[model samples]
Target chain A: MMGKHAQNRILAYSTPLVLIGILLVFVAAITLTGDKALGRMAAETLIRVVLVVGLWIFVGNSGVVSFGHAGYMAIGAYCSAWLTLKPQMKSLFLPDLPSWLAQAEWPVLPAAVASGLLAAFVALVSGATILRLSGIAASIATFAFLAIVNTVYSNWEGVTGATSSLVGLARYVDQWVALGWAAAAIIAANLYANSASGLALRATREDEAAASASGINMYRHRLLSLVVSGFFTGVSGALLGHSIGVLNPDSFYLGITFISLAMLVVGGIGSLSGAVVGVLSLSMMIEALVRFEQGISIGETQLALPSGAQEILIGIVMILVLILRPSGLMAGKELRMPRFAPRSPDYKTSNN
Target chain B: MTSLAQLFFDAASLGGIYAMAALGIALIFGVMNLVNFAHGEYIAFCVFALIVPSTEAVAVMFLGKAPAFLLIPVLLGLGAGAAVASEYVVFRHMRKATPVAMMISSFALGFVIQNALLAVYGGRPKAISLWPDLNTPVGVLGAQVPLLQLIVVLTTLLVVCALALLLKKTRLGLEMRAAAENFTMARLLGVRANVVITGAFALSGALAAAVALIMATQTGVADVRMGGQIMLVAFIATVIGGLGSLPGAVAAGFLIGGASVLLQAFLPLEVRPFRDAFLYTLVIACLLLRPQGLFAASSAKPRI
Candidate 1:
């Protein structure tokens, strides 16, 4: 039999292994059988995985519900567009861009990385002020941050094309690229979750007073996690812009914010596995509903629901799931191999 | 001088609507820690109740055609009933969940309600002419104020007075106040949890209806998204007013409204459209200055 230390090591490795396996299987199935539409759908789902995992990093570890992660995504998406769009097009559409940004043209990878760093930097600056507050106040402050970003992006005509769609972006992100990012997000989330800073943050999340008494600086830990969360969220946004081949400020608003939070909460907000699982399952359900909305032909009878019924049904389904499983499907537990299984420290009954 | 009078009237009327919306949000947050993201959809549902249920481009008034006497109560009742129904169907079952989970559930419910409205009413903003005469301007304190503005202001005062009376004089109100302070302690003192919670939902729902009527009358267009921006502002107001404090919410609502109007009036034409950006930055500054809010309730602080 393995020692406890050996088991703990196996448990750590196995959780991420299981997560990567799930994503790889998804990519393989879609690549082998799916057409272009399905390929696009797969790419969207993987990008959501990246986004949700990024969200899970801050929300899960700090226990702060941030409504502003999409703001970072907005920043990332626009920053990548600024860097990668043709110099000529930039001059035509974004005349007010700083001289350096207007003149620069970088490759996709560098642009995406830079996009993440830019977002991370913003998160750090914002968190310094916002993290001093706790609970609902912090949540509201993050929302204000999102609103500021959204309003500025939607109104700054010369640089962002204002409310109009920013078009002609190179569609550089595909299923393969999205899969890589999703995998990276999961690994990064798991690594951070197990790291010392992540542990300190989680401790603060559990009990702020006790954590602080033990010499943990709640503000600093929360800020670090927010930066990490913002970085990955920004990358996901870059990937999203590249995949859609266009950017619109409206796309980063309330709709995406709610949908991403729904996915994260549905899978479980407590574990890395939960974040990945939530996105995978919900994406599949949504796709299935979309296909159903389009109708499935059975023996010459095209059985179809009304066009918008899918959204209503999905909403009801989410409400039901929350009612039944208040802690979400995963309930904060990571997937582990049977022989090396250990009870999750976080898996206590909520004080409902 | 006339411009100043006009600005004050504009600010007050807009502030009245926002104050009502903020009260609805604060009432629910007081009893339950959950912030109902679906409150805006309640307003939308009420607006749509006025029109004939169809995907037609031009809306022929249904309930809206009724004279003011019949139309007002019916719409308010519908709003209250829908809110109560949502609480019973969705929120009641999820009381044991985390606040974050409950919030997402509320968002999902809002999504369902919005899409349902879309299915019945189509995705177009329909023009419904109800009480168009109310749009006529009347000279008030040297400002040409719309009659509807006076009505909105008066309606808000009436609601606030009525709510204060109900809370101060009635047993139900007493229970609600007790629950809002400390739900567990209230229950231990024999206060019925369900009754207080349900009552809060009903009142909140009614407030949402009041906002719907004012908004529909003011704009004359029933867009599915009409309530979203106001709801967001009210939500911010609820937070800035100190979470569970009713008076604080109303005050903050008016403050935000005044600020918004002032920004729009004073800012250069080029920056006028970016008014919300300036407003939200002030919100951030307010939070940093007083994280518990401008008027922090005793219970608003994080418990050590």
Candidate 2:
């Protein structure tokens, strides 16, 4: 048992250390690429890690599914984008915005936080109505919220561009900024996952009725996690939007929602490490495919499949995983050093 | 009144295709407890099937002089084969997993398929046009119905009736129903569970092929992106009616279809631009109130 525990400790640190090392190497490679595309990828990937880790907080702990995170990301992106782009443009694009919002141009950090807070507030409001339902109902409610948000984004022309918002926001999402935010997101999710309230959330997730009988406020715990996660997702949206330097309602469509979801599922649902692995691996694979097609062909045929076959392949992979290894690659296992955890008591260890 | 008839006819034609697609989706959900998010891609694959014979730029190899009715059966067979392969490769393995896993996998499958399709077909929505009038109307009940609409409605009715009879009178259909109701019990009775379940998926694929034809003819268009939009409607219709009930799904599909038409007719012009909003809101309301669905036999989370 001691040997197994020691092995677990070693295994945990090894992956992250390797990951961090790889991230640095990629960062170097991107810098070497001369162009900033690699840097943008790194920055966007960092943002993805943040959002996905936020997802891990609730999905991992509760084992319940929620689709509303994309909506939160949408809110965050537009909020920050709206702020930093310029007030005159906000007036032009977001004609329906309140007088105050129609005339505003904020800096990077404030705009980002405001976006997060806006999403978190929305989460707070939604959780009150939705958190009551357990399992599929809760999942469905989240989807409903997603649809409503998407509709609003699509139609609410005064603040949103309705279809297009070519905001000339300077590229503020440099690597340093993204790195700091990613660190914040990681720390926030990690702390929340292990906090006192986090424990209660986990308990509720395990057995809601039992957790309630044990005096855990199931709604409160789920809501708390959702609010925190919503903030991160919102920030991710802001950063991603800024990195791309263009924004549109269509950008956050169901397609992105599905890919984000697949990333979490394919990586390993409950683990932060899994989210990282999923994003990095999928991104690289896609990049390689794109690169491969651009470089050479197999005889007369392009060796390329169809346009959306990547999504199909992803679906096939997801289905295969569900059938063959339902728990995902990493399952619920955490990736952390032994130093991060408290030592088990002698009695507990000796008995085991 | 003339324009109104045309609009109704158009909506009905669209709805007919939607209903067929929904039925195909519901059929699999009935037995497997899966929503089959890859359904739209599978439908698109059928169009690809149609495209392949002529894709080689050789018209003579295909039915040059005659309408290639052979392509229809060939495509259905090929689609069924692909569907079964996907089921065996991916979904069959995860049938017993958690909902989160299942749902996520569906999303992944959708993404992979969409991107791959985009890579191959390009971003352009291809015109899968057909001969004669697809959208032109004929009068029915003071409102004009398109011939295509009539064909679609008639196709759905005939298919539904035939499927119902298959489920009732045929041994294979009965075995499928038995398996859907209680797999372990059916298994205990010496039924081959794997064969029956896979057969259900195969049947679903065949139906998808049939629906693809209606879809192609009704719209007078075919594009890879067509499945993404229509699949959601199938999902909403299936869930609102009842997850595993065929009759319920069909009823819901028509009801939702009628509702979408009615919304365009009755909704104030100010709200006319947001037709999808009204359509989805009704679906959401139906789902919220009838999570068990209007017609589903109450069962706990299906083992599948």
- Top of the candidates by lDDT: 1
Per-residue accuracy of model 1 over B136-196 as CA lDDT, tens digit each:
9999888899999999889888999999999999999999999888989999999999999
- List, residue by residue over A125-150, the lDDT tens digit for candidate 1: 99988898898899999999999999
Give the alpha-carbon lDDT of every model.
Answer: 0.91, 0.72
Candidate 2 error regions (>4 Å): A1-35, A208-217, A296-325, A339-352, B1-15, B52-72, B301-304
Kindly list the per-residue Cα lDDT of model 2 for residues B228-302, writing each as its tens digit. Answer: 777877777777777777777788878877888888778898767677776776666676676667887555353
Residue A233 error, candidate 2, Å: 1.1
Query: Could you tell me the lDDT of residue B267 within candidate 1?
Result: 87
Q: What is the lDDT of residue A25 in candidate 1?
A: 90
A-chain TM-score, model 1: 0.95
The candidate maximizing TM-score is: 1
Error of 1 at A118 (Å): 0.8
Model 1 alpha-carbon drift over 4 Å, by segment: A340-352
